[model samples]
Target: MMINSTQVSYFTLSAYFDTGLFKYLCFMIVMSLYVLIVGSNLLLVVVICMNRSLHEPMYLFLCSLFVNELVGSSGLFPFLLVQILSDSHTVSAPLCFLQIFCVHYYGAVEYLNLAVMSYDRYLAICYPLQYNTRMTYNKIATLIALTWLCPCCAMVVLMSLTSSLQLCRNTIYKVYCDTHSVVKLSCSDINVINVYGLIATFSTIFGSLLLILFSYVRILRVCFSGSKQTRQKAVSTCTPHLASLLNFSVGACFEVSQSRFNMSTLPNVLRIFLSLYFLTCPPLFNPVLYGLNLSKIRVIFKSLISNAA
Candidate 1:
């Protein structure tokens, strides 16, 4: 299939925020958000690591979570910040591929981290006695390693497959790098590639979420059969994770949908607004939701403050 003939070998992007006022506003907002996500997640990691009381399977997973959150955010935020502030948002072919790979890599890791965390909770709540035995330091290390490895494995396959494809010209509709956006740009036969990518992503997402839901259901059943206080505590402990999963799922769905359909029905401003919200909101909320809502984490924060004072 011949693309529209053009001497231009690459497509350059215009800044999403064309107006000076909007650019400055977005720069400030996104910068503030990046700082919050990085700061809060780092603090959470330190609190978990520095305190011997938190040296358990559960907090171990939380620390892994903070690291994953930072990894995921760093994959896109710095480049995005530059793009948002610059006169041009254009990126090169190699950089575009790198962006696409990093996104799926860390994004998939985030999902896997959630699954590991859910399993950790299940063991802690449902089988407290066996928790230590089942989730030893070595076991926790394996889980953390898997969290990073699984995503890296997928990304390597995905990038290898995508990089092999011939891209006629780069026409990214969205502000940031997205898998489908990059896939759609391929001039070669992408039918099989798209199908594989779609299946892999959907299976990873739906499969992990299904397992989490199943574990939580059993957890709730066990809690309900026990005491009322036990039930409340279990539910509260699960709330932050539930909220995080929900946000992540919603954002993924929106991103996939926007990629699938031509989003021309909505105005550009509204489209960009939704995209930005989906991309940035979940990471920012993850640490806050857990830190504020989980009593243990709140106590840790208090101790951290008291010790500092």
Candidate 2:
């Protein structure tokens, strides 16, 4: 018998282990992390916005990336804190779907944002003489818009497809709601949704990856043939971007493996840690990586701090 999606009121998150008094400790730890993520990402966003000197394509993209960290963290941390403290690990249907949407959207935006940044860097490095002409304000605006809009559109369809499924169960095996976990509960055939989901995921992930690859290939050719100054310029700007990309890709791989494959033999604690790694780490990681690595942001940030002090 198929249960309508509307009838499934809550999803029980089976992965949360009983921690008893440690629940308070967990709550505090999670809360502290959330506060740090918000504070750091927000600081960078404000710094970029307030300082006219930092209003370049790269900084603008960084600002958007930092804002996305806020969006992704806000979607998960509060809900996680509540669940951590509560005896019941169930989430409301509407809230579950909302979390799913936010998580997916956050990921999509991050990949595309990185891809766009790579392209920007490509222009700056490969064609320095024409970088200004190529990366005009209007063009930057359009790139940013498409980066966000594409994901928003894809996620809306993903959410709709998942929401329409006739769920035979309401137990999601992870700490948070995700498309794969929720879809696993469906009583009806999910071939169409699954296929569509695969296509969307592939196009978003690989498509961005391809663009990044192409950008960097051309970049490498220039670095090999050009002067030392050209290589320095490429290294200084591209290092943080590459590091951030690699870190996020690792986390994403862990998530995909855990979600798509059977890993019941792994320790619950390890599994949980791996599952939360992607969402938790990147928000905190990106701000630190960029803030410390990029000299301009670092100098401006330090000045802002000293002046305030």
Candidate 3:
């Protein structure tokens, strides 16, 4: 079917609009979620930046991760809140692709940041003598820059390729626009975008996962061989990073699976929740988990709470 690219100026968000009779209730719930996500993430970012003690490599990475959550949540929640309130969930073509870029870039950077954090932990725990020299402020700055830069550059290319596609469909089934969903809508040959996207996704996902595993393996080796105090300290530091990683990984898996698989058998409500879990859950949970688990952060956060009371 030949279709004019110019005609597809906007796309409709169809699937996620199935809130039925509880639309207003849905609005309130979504609004509240957005508030918590923004509040929690921003609080962490602010606390880290404000405190001199958290200027270390590990906390710097955590700060980057929190900033990423804010960016990722901004990409979806504001638009989602607006959509839940509106009668028609129509989004302009440019805005849709922009959202797609933000979402994908966020995911890619998230994994990369976690991998970097794991490596930082490994160096601190396993190589305490050289940890300071190796993980200098310059190195930390470079890692942070690369994490954000690589993803942004890749997403720009993906969007560039997608923008030229002759799209036949103007309705996206998922809650938000993503690379696969937008490329799949193309009316013509999608081989270029598909291949490039597969390469990007696989590299970003597995490459980071492997790095994280290597870091942890070395850390585990060191912990097992260390004294009681060392083991306790390693456990205390590594537990929170591992927990945040597990939380984010599950959400990332759901996003990837929902995009790749034909989940038509699932009910709309289930599908909707699954599709958006990445945008909502990790951002909300990571800050809370890390704040509670890390002793230094916990104390500072407590002091802040007490002072404000």
Candidate 4:
């Protein structure tokens, strides 16, 4: 029996295992993580916005990155907490699709934002003399706009395509609502949607990756031959970005692979951990990375703490 999109009222998530007495523990852990992600990301956002000195392109980009963390985590954690506590791990159709939209949109924006940040760093490090003039306010605004808007547009299409499909099954074998899982349930032919999804995923991931690569290549060349001061400047600014890029890329690769390939041999706990890593780690890792590494943010944060004390 096949059901059209309208008839499929809810999706049952089968990834959640019975933790029995530990379900309450899981709930507390997830709740704590959500609070931390929100608190840390919000703190940096507020810090960047309030300080006029921190209004540079780099800080502004960091602000956007932090905000994206909030957006991504919000999409996952609340729904996750509820699912963990609920005996029936089911989500309404509308809510599931919304989660899909938010999660995918968050991912696209994250890559684009990082790509633009790499370009910003490339300018600041390689062309220090003209950094101010070259990275103008208008250009920064445009880059930020494109970063967000492009993802928003792509996700709208992806969601539309996914939502229109006639699902043969309503069970998703994952802890969260993902596009691939939904696509797999389609009773109708989804070759076109699959191809479009591939194109979109490749273009978003590799397109941003290529730009990041080009920027870093030039950055590396300058770092090797340049003076000690130039090298130090590059290290200070680029370290966090590189760490962030590497971390996210690894988690994302595992997630994509898990989604596309047969990974049933792996333990369910391991699968759950790897799948959630990309979503959970970046939000927690980034604030700590940038906060400690960047002097301006660190100093300002300390002063704020002292003042509050």
TM value for model 1: 0.91
Segments of candidate 3 deviating more than 4 angstroms: 18-21
- Clashing pairs in model 3, backbone N/Cα/C closer than 3 A: none
* lDDT of model 4, residue 278: 89
Better of 2 and 3 by lDDT: 2
Highest lDDT against the true fold, candidate: 4
Model 4: what TM-score? 0.98
Error (Å) of candidate 3 at residue 220 is 1.0
- Model 1 spans > 4 angstroms off: 1-11, 14-17
lDDT for position 216 in model 1? 92
Give residue 86's error in model 3 in angstroms: 1.6
lDDT tens readout by residue for model 3, 1-309: 345777998888888655676888988998898899889889888999999998888888999999999999999988887887778888999899889888888899999999999899989998999999999999999999999999888988888899999888887887778778877788889999889998998999899999999999998898888999889988888898888888888888888889889999998889888888877888988998888888889999989989999
Q: Could you give the candidate ranking by lDDT, starting with the highest?
A: 4, 2, 3, 1
What local distance difference test score does each model get? 0.78, 0.93, 0.87, 0.94
For residues 1-309, what per-residue lDDT tens digits would candidate 2 score against the true structure?
Answer: 356666899889999999989999999999999999999999999999999999999999999999999999999999999999989899999999999999999999999999999999999999889988999999999999998999999999999899888888888889999999988898889998999999999999999999999999999999999999999999999999999999899999999999889999999999998998889999989999999989999899788779999
Report the C-alpha lDDT of model 4 over 52-116, residue by residue, as the tens digit.
99999999999999999999999999999999999999999999999999898988999999999
Model 4 root-mean-square deviation: 1.0
RMSD to truth, every model: 2.5, 1.2, 1.4, 1.0
Task: Tell me which residue pairs clash in candidate 2.
Answer: none
lDDT of 1 by residue, 1-309 (tens): 345424324445532647677877877887898999999999999888887987888778878878877877887788888887777667876777787777777678778888888888888788877878888899899989988887788778888887777767676788887667767667779887877887878877877887798889879888978788777767787788888888887877776677778788898887876665655777788888888987888997787689899
TM-score of each: 0.91, 0.98, 0.96, 0.98
